[model samples]
Target: MKKIIYTMILAAGVFSTTACVDELDQTPHTEITSGDVYTSAANYKSVLAKVYASYVIAGQEKGGGNKDIATTSGYDYMRCYFNMQECGTDEMASTWLEGDKVKDISYLTWDASDPWVSDTYYLIYQTIDYANEFLRNATDDNISKFSDSDRALIKQYRAEARFLRALSYYHAMDLYRNIPFVTEKDEVGSFTPPRYTSSQIFDYIESELKDIDGDLLDRSEAEYGRATKGAAWTLLAKMYLNAEIYTGKARYSDCITYCNKVIGDGYSLEGDYSKLFNADNQKRTNEIIFPLSVDATHTVSWGATTYIVCGEVDGNSSENPLTYGVKSAWSMFRLRGELTSLFASGDKRAMFYTKGQSQYLDTGIDTQTNGYLMTKYRNLLDNDSVASNTASYGASIDFPMFRLADVYLMYAESVVRGGDGGSIGTALGYINKLRERAYGSTDGDVKTTDLTKNFILDERARELYMEGTRRTDLIRYGKFTTSDYLWQWKGGVKDGKAVNSKYNYYPIPQTELTANPNLHNDNY
Candidate 1:
């Protein structure tokens, strides 16, 4: 699947957007028209390939200048998502101020004009538009033209496309509460997309997942990196877990219902947590439900796992890039001083490289040596410490977007939040599985009485740091903009003060408002 992404010829032209020009800048792949590209059934698969490939590659060439969604310098889809999700929380700190919204994201000072935020907005919409184009082309009449086996397969492909679009909408709803929502039903040329309330977006996402259930392949049967029953179940479970926040309705019971589906199926914890982030992540397919598949030979975007691997490296140890299986050391982002205490005694998950770095960001994010560095992610093969070719290209490491570990955490959290049909004992057993893997023993296990919402939150920080869940977790727990929780440099202040409640909902990009008359700031 990783090599197939490069083997297929990228579609020359994709569906163009009709939304206000300021909100969308979707450049065509070539002079070729969407009609010419989707005429043949073989091209149907290729267009679908474009949908999945959009997550890993920025443009035609590997990290080349001919780009798709241009915004910031290193504006990879997940890379900017990481900035929005982690940098302002206690889990991560960034020193990068060069890009559009690098500083704003790290300090929680982002506004409508912030370039990176705007780019990220366009990128998410671009992804949805790609999926929409695929769905529109791969229709029932189109499927009828194919062989029986091909017809069955094409149906599955449509389900995967819907799931991907729903995933993007979930991200949009998470980052920016109220947003413009569109689907394949909405044609390419648009005057103004009706602004969707947070609940409207949530209902659309939930129904989309449920509608595609029969068409999705079973998790065990689906190929790696493609959406399957487990992926859909996991995503639905996640939205349900956050139902109160998204829709003002408690859906913990539904969260548990779907979580049981994933649990009853086959996913489990990988024996080693380190292998989950390493280059040979494909081997951990039993645990990782969906990933943005990447390798050094192809999909060389600096925005995904490459940024994750290189960004963690301290430039002072420039000689150690190969040690982490990449050629360059960004050393731009690091663990917050507050995170140092999360790793208690004997937690093997602690992979800090503090020899020449400070445990705390004493002088703040500017100085490279101000904060401790991490060895959590390595771009080399799991078995081989020394990998070749990775030094010249970017990282070969794949980022696990959703995995069994997250499912386990979600189940435990739902149970704690008054979700029914899941026993506290079962939740304990699931969490202990992660603890045993992290500590290599049962010594770190906790009793049923020890399982609380606070424990679940900290456990998530300890386990899911840098995987892009921190900011959302903080918001869900009522600690993001309130005085309830404070970390270093939050709200652009070194001491970490409570920001305005408006930070809860990031302002709509001013560009979006000016271009689309239907858009308003009343929600923000």
Candidate 2:
């Protein structure tokens, strides 16, 4: 497995800027051409690395210079996604009052003009376009001059590029239900891509995933942070799991099939749940199917797990500063009351600081002690060692985008959802496996009778908190916009209230719609 080093490719700067153009007729502001960049197989590998780098690194030059998207501060793919996914749900709350529409997200008052919304939308397309450009230039005929081994590598790279495009489109379909669909064949700056319905996008993603299934690296063979067969299976299972939400059709049986494929690929849960999130998570590749690899030294950025580590630290906690492995705490994010209640007192997964912080959020004020601070995603290793660098600006922790534990949960949920070809007994066993780890013993394990639809939802919250899956889980359970499940500061009220159902899917960013005439906003 090769370490994914963020090397500066020759025309990467031009590639980054050109893929972000919104206008159909505007020429890209670049001096280099595709021929100069894609002349050799090594160059193609470098560009492929750039396509992966687009998600973690915010700018062309490292550390706060020449940003990929300049409209928002701390604008990166995972950071923006975390703000939209975790902050708005019951899992997290923030007291950072810099007025970046984070409060809007926490309170469920976001609109099309929100900066994070625009940032996320632009970042998704930028990633998709980058993948598109790679697939376009890295074709077999174009790379015919390369050696046999390099050509084989380029073939895998092309498949990975397609997988990445499908992943971004999946995000678009999940977040913005209706979006302009583009691909490698779509000529840049020639015509505006038309919008596709959510169902159409769903079919496209399903087909793309299946088409590349044979071409991708085996689940056990891919390098760390690279997409593999398990990653595609996880994404496909997720799509099928939420098929009803996206396409108004139930595909639980299909979801179970893919989940089983990933489960059979030999991924096991990490013996210690806490170690699965720490700085050295990259070393624990047995469980993590795919990770957004972050390092404090090489892949330094303000986004990724840096947001999780710094933002969740408490200002006045009794723990040593080195316990967090970061220079200073941002003291921004905290867990809401509803999230803390899901864990039992003995459950080790309740990794929250409650000394000075209150469980209840009163008045919805932006104070340090308003809510319990979370320590789930620390910068320390499992052995309590600090990461290599302690800089406040960068964190060494890697964010696990998909792991085997979630696959187990998905299997259980699919069984509870009346999915065929899977047994309730196996689903119960999977749920208990997680419980045994969470409790450090089999004492907390539940039987088949306890495995209900509602129990699976609560168990997901307990097992997968602050992992950027809460909002989607809430929406699938029909509690995101209803009063049945409310957290502090929901609907901009301290007591928490129901919001409009239209918020289930975020509106397409207003900036995108204004720049491209083919796109339109969802009527929320």
Distance from true position, residue 31, model 2, in Å? 4.1
The best candidate in terms of lDDT: 2
Q: Which stretches of candidate 1 lie over 4 Å from their true place?
A: 1-7, 27-29, 70-74, 98-101, 385-391, 522-524
Q: Tell me which residue pairs clash in candidate 2.
A: none
The window of 10 residues in a row where model 1 has the poorest summed lDDT is: 1-10
lDDT per residue (tens digit) for residues 173-289 in model 2: 888898888887777666567889999999999999999888899966776788998999999999999999999999999999999999898889899888888888887788999
Error in Å for residue 333 of model 2: 0.6
Candidate 1 lDDT, 1-524, residue by residue in tens: 25333344565555666557544565666688777776555666677777787777767677634777554444667776777788778888776755424787777777787776777777788788889878877889756767887878788888988999999999999888888877777766754688998899999999999999999989777777788888999999999988888899999989999989988888778898899988888889889988888876767777688888888887675347777887778777878878877888889888888877787777876667777788899987867664435445667788889998898999999999999999899999999999999899999999999899999999998898889898888889999998898887888777888987767766667877888777776534
